[model samples]
Target chain A: MKQLGLSVREDAVGNIFGRWVGSEAELGAVATGSHVDAIPFSGKYDGVVGVLGALEAISVLQRSGFQPKRSLEVIMFTSEEPTRFGISCLGSRLMAGSEELVRSLKRTVDNHNVSFVDAADSAGYKIHPDDLHNVFLNQDAYFAFIELHIEQGPILEKEGIPIGIVTAIAAPASIKVEFEGNGGHAGAVLMPARNDAGLAAAELALAVEKYVLESGSIDTVGTVGILQLHPGAINSIPSKSHLEIDVRDIDEKRRNYVIEKVHKSAIDISKIRGVELSEFKIINQDPPALSDKSVINAMEFAAKQLGLEYKLMISRAYHDSLFMAREYHQWV
Target chain B: MKQLGLSVREDAVGNIFGRWVGSEAELGAVATGSHVDAIPFSGKYDGVVGVLGALEAISVLQRSGFQPKRSLEVIMFTSEEPTRFGISCLGSRLMAGSEELVRSLKRTVDNHNVSFVDAADSAGYKIHPDDLHNVFLNQDAYFAFIELHIEQGPILEKEGIPIGIVTAIAAPASIKVEFEGNGGHAGAVLMPARNDAGLAAAELALAVEKYVLESGSIDTVGTVGILQLHPGAINSIPSKSHLEIDVRDIDEKRRNYVIEKVHKSAIDISKIRGVELSEFKIINQDPPALSDKSVINAMEFAAKQLGLEYKLMISRAYHDSLFMAREYHQWV
Candidate 1:
């Protein structure tokens, strides 16, 4: 931002913004930005491409002697990944004025037991609990929001496409389920006498696949990404098993239906296996977002002028754009 | 042993023996003993009852002024549980002249990475690599061995039996299997594109249950006691999954057959799921032990003389007696 000679500012929740003032600066700004936060063991291209790509775009535009009518802002949203607080798109969720999320922010803690408020405060963003509305952006805060991100999937590569214009972002829901049973010595416990929680979890994991496939949509996908068996030893029958499940789809209703089916299957599996379904929690369920018509038209027109081949595709992996779409009408 | 004025000695691998001298000390000793080591989170009575019960039996014989031509001995074996070195009945296995096991003992390390030899030496039982045979008992060292152990299962209690005469012990096989697949963002990866290792492991776990039940014997049992998914995050598809399986049966051939079925199923699941079966290791498989007819008859005669109700039963949970039966002609 300094090299591009833009005025810089940061929001209360540590969302960094660099604005290039235009002749009509009073009008709603045109924003192009993305998060820099990343998950562990992830590739470098995920969020880095968007953040650096926006800056590069600004540099290129300035070198071309182009001046915008509306102020152009580049934002680096805070905590886009759930790696720290077990919640994604934290900054944008606040900016979108999600009341329930804002109310629960102070109570949220990381795996290390550090509260979200304290972490933000220590990072120089002092959060005011009662006055959290300051972080929320008003209607028409941005004339348009466009993020430049690398495709996170293999679809484009498989089709030998050079570029993809995301038309819609997928909805995602996270669930945690745990089953408990009476554990004993593996050798001492007979097959008929054992109520194994691990087997119950296995049954549920397979059921998640079964239900998602039953949905009959390639856009719909589900994963039992984390499976843990308690007292995990070779000779000890598992007394409890915990699973973290992720389900997503471009269709909100379809995703929710799959989630409901998973819950029913979990209950049925526990009862039949004689294990207790101790917990089945839905951590978050955000609705899908569509790209604005004007934004899609403008991007396609630009691609055509550049003589670049581009495919319009739905984004199964979501981003800060998913939450920002809630606040701004023109978001892609 | 000191209170009873008997000679006490410990072997090279920490097998403690207390011998009550009789009229003919050179005669083969009538031995009765068990291990006191236990796995974590276990009840107090699994191995403890056998050790204490042996001492109580000695006390009762002394009080009755019983005189025998052969000496009576109580031996407390070391490291019966695989809690430390991943090998059960260590002392008894050595005593049974398991040359293959003894050869690997020096290299065996606990979870803390402390070698078995170092652990034994630190406990005041120094071992000599070439002279490991000192720990092996002679074939005729014991005239007869009768271990008084508490039933580890519910069968005796369900039948309200006061005494159970051991007829046979189950053979157990431990297997460690690992599967690997390409991991990616859960949402980004399409259902058809995913070769999920976690799902492969789940299929194998369910297969273990299916095959064990198909064995057509109540004595046959199998368990997937340990399962782990690598880089286990809710939004990350599992790239790797590890499982530790346990299979057991009173009949060795039946147990081995079930293990073969499980292995075949594992390969089939991996191939079908497009995940690599990176590891499929049989850690250990030991033959089953059966009590001598003479020892069972002697126990039955004693119970009948005392007017006690007794039932002949199979021991599903292996112990030091399982290995000790390998060296001695008469073991119960």
Candidate 2:
């Protein structure tokens, strides 16, 4: 554990991992977790809270002069936000041996001109392809890996709970929709003749809202977070529009239905308005993670011992634990 | 006419008049033509065709060695396009002693900043008020005034005829409507939470189209030619929107109804979107003109003498004849 100086050992594509050693050297380790990176201008509580809070918990245990049969280690993962490296949870995804995603993040966010190699070097990281073998080397050695995170949705707050034991992390699929139409002078044109891109985009956005409302499913949620219009002048007819759709659901079927509805609405609006429409599903299937039943039981048992109120809830936000579970399915 | 060189004598507002001496100089003159100035961008045949064509007829008479008992004069009024100096047929209106209209035109577009006297100087014309008085002084001496003009509408064309004798000019009321809404971020704010100035403006625009469609009246037409949205970013929820509504009709009640519908739609949309909305009306009313029955008879008789296909039709587009008839009351 002490061989790497707690310095990151990255893979060929710049997946980074930093390990800390614990007092119990002979027994296999127990991993305590959190991601180190953040979103742009993000509140300190988001990912940092879990990372720092885990460190404090370990420090508290160590200061009390207690030595466990298994060693405890803290991990600081690299590039979780996709802000700097154009990928979310790259470190965890790689550690979990997900080859499909490992290659996909490389080509994403093309406009940023960020190559995987450049991102690693710029962040003072070094990659070693041999180290990837380590991911599969010690599956049985680790007792269990645990992660703490802030519930990003209102479910916990609405339920009047201070802490929640996540049952499963909801899968998120980000979709990009673009509408294209002819641009011209607004004054000289008649309404019936216009193939207005902005109007088409607006109709699609409203349709998404309508779909979600009519579906009457609490688990399904949709958001059109970013909308960009080309030649966006009030006096000029819009020529093109770009929008991002963030859709999520605890159940994959419901999420797929919502996405399918959005796609159909875009096509319908485009046909009605004589506009060309295209949609790219950037995130197709983010598999939801059912929290390790053993982990949930452990948390409940600990909460009872500490006299803390805790409830089991689904995690609306994605986390590294999902990938970890998929990697070591039997262990989870 | 001699005082103004070989050219005809025009009044202070540039209305042209030519007089030919008779065998007995004491005899009164007969005016046999209409104004020379044309409507804005109108066909050359509207007013000028009649005046010049009549002059050619007069030349033919002179060449044939024919002499009338009385002298003949041709007249042309100025500012027929509602020139910078004043409103429709300002020369005829002034000659007819409609001082109230002159004052209104002066105050309206000119705002008294450029008085008619100053406007004349700017146009390189010099005239004394005394000279203007002399021009109108001999109005009672005229035996009769007649006019010729090509009908401006398609009634003649639809009937497969070539010429039209004027019956009446339809009244036109031009109206302008302006709509004013708050702008914000489209992402952070939900559609249900947005005031969405652009959407409200669009609702009003569509309402205008619907009103024109449902009214089912041929005389009434509405146009939304100018629309402006402030800070018009696709990602921005528009804060303010301005739209120009132009409504015109021969019937004042129909015109008022269209304007009223547009106004009500704006208010309704504003309330629905939870935004502040205000409107400004620019243009109000212009009355119709009925052509002189004698003038129509003269034109029809002339067409019959020449064996030309002719029909009586009303003028859809407004003309100086409107104000001329309003002022002179008997000129048409």
Q: What C-alpha RMSD separates each model from the true structure?
A: 4.2, 13.9
Could you give candidate 1's per-residue lDDT for residues B199-241 as a string of tens digits? 9999999999999999999888898888999778788899999
Give the number of the best model, judged by lDDT. Answer: 1
Candidate 1: residue B297 Cα off by (Å): 4.9
Q: What is the TM-score of each candidate against the true structure?
A: 0.84, 0.52
Model 1 per-residue lDDT tens digits across residues A1-332? 97899999888888889999989988999998898877767788878888898999999999999998999999999888876776778888888898988877869887679998889789877788765778789888799999988787898899998889989999999888999999887887798899999999999999999999999999999999889997887788899999989999999999999999999999999899999999998878999999999999999999999999999999999989998899888979
Off by over 4 Å in 1: A1-37, A54-75, A83-86, A102-143, A301-308, B1-37, B51-79, B83-86, B102-150, B159-163, B294-310
Candidate 2 lDDT by residue in tens digits, B188-271: 333344465655665676676679667787656554434455554322345666655545555767767777777777778777
Q: What DockQ does every candidate get?
A: 0.55, 0.03
Fnat for every candidate: 0.68, 0.01
- Expressed between 0 and 1, the share of native interface contacts present in candidate 2 is 0.01
Error of 1 at A323 (Å): 1.3
